[model samples]
Target: MESTEVLRISRLARIDLDQDEGARFADQLTKILAYFEKLQEVDTGGVSPASHPTDLVAPVRADRPDGWEAPRDLVARSDGHTDEFYRVPRVLE
Candidate 1:
């Protein structure tokens, strides 16, 4: 970028870039853009897409017997609140 353009970008973006910082960033950006330009010279032929590089096995979990309570019984065990909401102490200041 031209010096004026770089200065204008810094001001419009509300960023403070000293002379060295601005020049360094501009040079690095130019080099990265040039790298993208070089990538256009590649020829990729007959490559199958793959989600993973190796075979993966599924893990299993041990099942144990634990008596489950009904939802209505659980709600009834709370301190006098309906199933739709829980009762809590008033938090007013």
Candidate 2:
């Protein structure tokens, strides 16, 4: 990676970089790109791509509907509540 390329990348990413910073990033990016290039040279003829490194299965719980009971005592305590619902002031006419 060249300093000019790094400057262009910084501009695209909306980042402000000084001349020294641009040069430093150029060197770092070049090393990282070189490492990726080196990785490309490895032979993986029989190796399969894996989502996870380990073969452990995740434990899943059975899904069942749990019945919900309303708080009838709370509604009874509220001044604005009727039998089961709480009444709010009308917002619009």
lDDT of each: 0.77, 0.87
Count of backbone clashes, every candidate in sequence: 0, 0
Candidate 2's residue-wise lDDT over 1-93, tens digit each? 988889888989999998788888999999999988987788988989899989999988889877667677778888798888888899999
State TM-scores per candidate: 0.33, 0.43
Best by lDDT: 2
- Candidate 1 C-alpha lDDT tens digits along 28-58: 7667878889866876567665778766766
Error of 1 at 17 (Å): 0.5
Q: Which pairs of residues collide in candidate 2?
A: none
Cα-lDDT of candidate 1: 0.77
Q: How far off is model 1, as Cα RMSD?
A: 12.6
